[model samples]
Target: MFGIYIHIPFCRKACHYCDFHFSTSLNYMDEMVDAICKEIALKADRVSGTAGSIYFGGGTPSILPATALQKIFQTLEKHFDIATGAEITLEANPDDLNAAALKTMRALPVNRFSIGVQSFFEEDLRWMNRAHHAGEAIDSIRRSQDAGFENLSIDLIYGYPLLSDEKWESNLATAISLQVPHLSSYSLTVEPRTALAAAIEKRKEPAPTDAQSAEQFRMLMARLQSARFEHYEISNFALPGQYAVHNTNYWRGVPYLGIGPSAHGFDGHTRYMNMASNATYMQALLRGQLAEERELLTDHDRYNEYVMTSLRTMWGLDPELVISRFGRSYHDYLHTALGKLGSNDWLISGDGKIKLTTEGKLYADHIASELFKVDEE
Candidate 1:
């Protein structure tokens, strides 16, 4: 089934490492919400059937008040046939999940909360410029749980300068103790033009090292595996039956409608990217138009996308399906690439699927790139 994604582009504070399209100002909150609702109504006919998942992702979806969120939900229900028991997720920051906030969120259709608790230490939070402290991080989860929102996921970041191995272990242990069903963790990469990258260039902050990231990732896998969490995707761990429906739909190439500035939508064969500028996005919607660019995907694009995403999951890649869907030429190309990999212990092939070994995950990007069919037909 298709999915719906709404991008909330406002945040209270800008995290140092974030380069995602967002504004620290809330001046246009009402107008932005209006524009998002309008966009949703305007694009309602794009997806034919029911939506199985609705994800509210952003600079901080929790930054919006319940009224604004409720209005958006109203618009969605009006235009789309959202499936019964659809997984509705809101990505919230720790500091915004107070008692009043949690109460309001429960009033909406949101059944899942993905809290951005990047670390459990004050120093790490401060270093990353997170809006919440260590206490709020723990309290937010407990508060949300108390509010009867148990379908919860928390994000944790590793490979940053201040995150030691011992500290990483502590972070994992704390999350396990909280009994949250899902975890999405990632390495802190310094994206160009972000505050973190600028600091690194000026020698004000130490850059994250590859070796450190690799070692910590190993620790993450072992610890989570023992805790009965499935490493279903490269950076995602979840208890049984707790996988995130929205993100899983994304990886499996389920078509979705993305609403709001800097959001993206895909319909199997094409991609739509919204304008990153908030003003531009709102202006277009005000004029009853969408400020987005659409690209028709080539076979090359589809093949690479499938390989990149499917290889990172426990499901692995099926060569025969590739042959059936993308044609024999593409499958032949993949076979040739595999031969070139030679004696590398990074991949295992069985049951007509090729999957990455634990060591191979460290080089997931490299491996996918090597397997990519780059040239034209």
Candidate 2:
């Protein structure tokens, strides 16, 4: 029931707001892919059982040449016991998708395709410096469906300074019209040191407003709910039985192995992150070293991690699991914190499960922080 995530750190173009570790250059793609395969082989013993899901995420996984992708998949199959019906997902950009490319993808065992279609408006695409056009976004999904990819997901972004509320509505309507089974929507945040932030400081671009973003989020929830899509997580919507098993496992604290530069891996108690520099990662791997940093979790850190992730999902936190894994004292601390929030109507406890109402979801992080176990001074 473990999952595998492969990070392809190369993209054709850099989006202004993206803070994810990725390079616009493809010069090191071959070496990087080789290094990823080596890393996978080196870390094979970390997870004990067969893989239930394998996700190819990235700078843009679709940018990989089909031959290269096939090689990576073949290498993984060689080293791991991938389940026969495993959910294999590839995060792709619209420009890289074509009839022939999709046909090749279908031939492989990949069953899910998560297409990056941030907007269906050319102006927004230009503002974001995305590599594809608005037309390509629609065409890509249409072609994917025609190519027999029923389990499809599309990524959408709202709250951009340039995205009007009307445009945001149009974007969701477009996805619904395409009949996409799953969606991963996000609010645009200006990360420090990214081009988007720089542009705002330089007066070259307008900054995103909190009020606008909040309104758009409210609109998103209402529209998606009306369409009968389940708001299973803070930023995800899916049709029945279409939730992303890979991401769901991560939220539930399931162990997973992540490969490639800047990738992260987590067992229940420990976490590892690969070096962000491509050259350093490859060099270290060549020397038979895992170029990664590791952190040993403290009891407080584990409790905080569970609260942060579980609160964002529909499943909420389980008191019984916490008491068994953490301790009676930790469990008692949770009850105390729950009592405070429950009185505030931010949390509802029933059937041994604690869940947040719609009002509570707005301050989910704040609530989780209040429940966090602070270390003794």
Top model number, TM-score: 1
**Poorest 10 consecutive residues by lDDT, candidate 2:** 338-347
Clashes of each: 0, 0
Q: Candidate 2: lDDT of 169?
A: 91
Which pairs clash inside model 2? none
- Tell me how candidate 1 scores on lDDT: 0.95
For each candidate in the order shown, give its overall lDDT on alpha carbons.
0.95, 0.90
lDDT of 1 by residue, 1-377 (tens): 89999999999998999999999999999999999999998998898999999999998999999999999999999999989999999999999999999888877899999999999999999988999999999999999999999999999999998998999999999999999999999999899999899999999988899999999999999999999999999999999999999999888889999999999999889899999999999999999999999999999999999999999999899999899889999999999999998988899998989999999999999999999987654
Once fitted onto the true fold, the runs of candidate 1 whose alpha carbons sit more than 4 angstroms away are none
TM-score of every prediction relative to native: 0.99, 0.97
Off by over 4 Å in 2: none
The total number of steric clashes, by the backbone 3 Å criterion, in model 1 comes to: 0
